[model samples]
Target: MIHQPPVHFLGKTLTGQPVQKQVRKLKDLDNIFLDQAAFSAADMNRVVYEVFSYLPVDEGTEGGLFFGMTHLYPGTVGQEFYMTKGHFHTIENRAEYYWCVEGEGMLLMMDKHRNTWAEQMQPGSLHYIDGYTAHRVANTGGGILSFGACWPSDAGHDYATIVKNGFSRRLLSVEGKPALV
Candidate 1:
């Protein structure tokens, strides 16, 4: 098989070529937020976040790597902070890495046993997500929260599991500060 040519990127700014973009709108996360009323009353067309990925090889290709950037806008659905739709990898043994590149946030993680925890994310912070963990990112700051991620190309997302069970904890803004509830 022919291999992809070398690619370059601006690490700090997350700018690169041959990237695929996907935008996630408020309506796309129907049951993600804690406040149903707030979500219902909010603008469904509002963009919550966007993902830019540099997939050198087709997704789900074994032995290949996937790189991407997640840009979560600053906002809230009621008291809850804006967050990604958390997910587990279809290939449960697949691990991933996340690096905070442009903003402040929280890397929330939950294990298969439902135990949950979080790590503060800031520019230059790096995190390792274990294979058995399901993870989500929450923008807890006053500005857009952007981060870079790397994972095995074969580690397909298992969003259905998260949508079905949901995370054990929720990150909310209390008195203008981020709190895990």
Candidate 2:
């Protein structure tokens, strides 16, 4: 089922698309799911993919490609739940942010200088960080930590995915034939 402009988050609806009404979903997974039908292409090449999961971007090599996302989940009644493991980023032009729709937690942040900071994140709370800032989300409640994340490809480069993964890297720029810091 098609909808108007600015459809819901993650570009889809939980109800699934009308074209595949016959599909059946197993209810016990309590996993990350994306209602793909709620979103549409802005142009010929653009596309949207929505899903529910415990991980973000999981494991991949699309680190250099620009992509955006939004997440919505209901908080549970536990203290050990979180959207993802603590992580760090390596990109240089990412603009990332998160809006906590439910539950409470701490916004973990670390910078290139190896400094750290933590801020409380509750429902209706929002945080936006620069691309160079490394950070992650830490849930500390007996409820589901629900939030929405939306950012350009630049956002990924500015996140804490790298540190969370115990990684090291070196990139060379052909323009000046030199390595970047």
Residue pairs with backbone atoms closer than 3 Å in model 1 (clashes): none
Q: What are the per-model numbers of colliding residue pairs?
A: 0, 26
lDDT of 2 by residue, 1-181 (tens): 9956332244222232211111112231122112212212112122111233222233333553322322323221121222333344444556566767766666666666656666677878888866656655544555555566555533334223442432122222224222212
Model 2 off-target regions past 4 Å? 1-3, 10-83, 154-181
Which candidate number would show the highest TM-score if scored against the true structure?
Answer: 1
Mark the 10 consecutive residues where model 1 has the least summed lDDT: 5-14
Q: Which residue ranges in model 1 land beyond 4 Å of their true spot? A: 1-6, 11-17
Q: Which ten residues in a row have the lowest lDDT in candidate 2?
A: 16-25
Q: TM-score of predicted model 2?
A: 0.48
